[model samples]
Target: MKPFTDGDFIKTVIIQAATRWFPGEDNRRDFMNIVQNTRLSPATITRKVNVMADHVHEQLNIDLKKCVRFSIHLDESTDKTDTAQLVVMIRFVLENGSVQEELLELIPLTRKTTGLDVYLSKKNSILAHEVPLEKLVAVTTDDAPSMTGKITGFSGQCLRDPDFPRFLSFHCIITPRSILWENFKYKNRV
Candidate 1:
């Protein structure tokens, strides 16, 4: 039997499954097992997935620019390699009443988290490539003092000036799990 190599079909199935199933970290290995059992080389499957992701990103970029109102969600996480990275995700409502979210960029934090200036500079540089700073409607982030300070400083310096455009910034409070559970229980009882 010849090796079954249909990149497009495999890619479509993988993408659909990933999007629909919402597979967690452990489920990913099971997903890979299924793919491997298909008689397709792992490399071929990997390449196909990369191609699909690239295509999705290209379409998303075009769609995002045409959107008038959108929201920016910024979060930071540690990758498997133990590198601290900032992930910028954009949420937009299309003209057809459909909501679309795309991962805009992942920026590695080179310096220590204490260095607000360095982090701000890197964030600005990364964001400038995706969308104009002036066009941002609102920014959502956690209640980190450094992050809040940077946003205030940046907005004041760049957007508040007479020559620049003004934008809105919203901070979302993130608390510990115990506090969150208590709040959730209180809200439920109310």
Candidate 2:
């Protein structure tokens, strides 16, 4: 057989496998060794993955541009490495009024993470996607102290920005209780 050179099939399988959450690296290596029989190197795989991600980024940005009004959801946390990572997602109403949410970015903080820093960084990233600032309708974030602090949180920082739209800000409602858990026992009727 003349080297499997079908980009379409390769892309398809990569997409399929990527969507799955399991299987350790060794398993993938073994499978590739047997089936692919000397296929793309790790660098090549990385390049292909980057290509796919770039295509998705472009497509998502285009969709955001078309949306008249959109909502944003943000989450920030420190990974095991102690790097602060921020996840950004957007929800928009499609032409048929069906809502869709797409993850936009995962920004890693190199230094101290503050409410103003996140606000500015997120604003730059969202605007870079060509989404009009005025069209922002909502901003949802977890009730982390840095996200909703009365004076120094992300929401407050955004509210103070003259360019940021007057959007509804909400905290993620993963449970009935607040993030500080003040309402946890009360909600459980304990």
Candidate 3:
């Protein structure tokens, strides 16, 4: 029997269901069992998903061209496969005063994830998307050593760049407000 690999609706449905429930498994049998036998081979589903991702990525690049200013939040963490992945998210203000936040990319660190590694990955992503560096206003990252180390960290490299905009680099504080208050009180004797 031939696969029902026609129409945009089927592709959309497959993409939605795959993203919703599959999470990790992209097995044809798993999808067929749960998604009512769409008869799509694993290869077809993978191709459709890749095309959709490319479309979204292109749309984001276009939207970025409309931004008056943008800030990026980056976090690096080890995935289930023990690979270091950098999650880059962008928050930008459009010319019409509307704000938007989006996941720019998830980059895998194939080698040592040093400050240079993180910085290069982010720089490549921004350059590939053709986002103007002058429009970048800030960056936020967790207080990891590779992120906060002024002399050797990602922010340091950006700061050293002459063409790069003078952007604020802030450490994102994720602790509870109550705990922070207690710490402040103890430190300041207030």
Among these predictions, the greatest lDDT belongs to 3
Model 1 ranges with Cα > 4 A deviation: 1-39, 79-82, 114-129, 150-164, 175-190
TM-score for candidate 1: 0.58
Model 2 over residues 1-190: C-alpha lDDT tens digits?
Answer: 2343454476558645743533677766666555455356556666788899899988887777777788888888788999999888889976667788988888887777788788778988977888877888899987677787757888898888888889898988573334448666567884
**Residue 184 of candidate 2: its Cα lDDT?**
65
For model 2, how big is the CA root-mean-square deviation?
9.7
Candidate 3 lDDT over 28-101, as tens digits, reads 54664555645456577678888999999888898899899999998888899999999899999999999999
Per-model TM values vs. the true structure: 0.58, 0.69, 0.70
Cα error of candidate 2 at position 117, Å: 1.3
Global lDDT scores for all candidate models: 0.62, 0.77, 0.83
Name model 3 segments beyond 4 Å from true. 1-39, 175-190
Tens digits of per-residue lDDT, candidate 1, 1-190, equal 3344565476558856764575586677677666656655657666777899889877876787667667676665568987777667777776787877777777786665433543475357445545544455666655555445544433334443453345576766763554889889999994
Estimate the overall C-alpha local distance difference test score of candidate 1. 0.62
Residue 13's C-alpha lDDT in candidate 3? 74
- Give the better candidate number (2 or 3) by TM-score: 3
User: Which pairs clash in the backbone of model 3?
Assistant: none
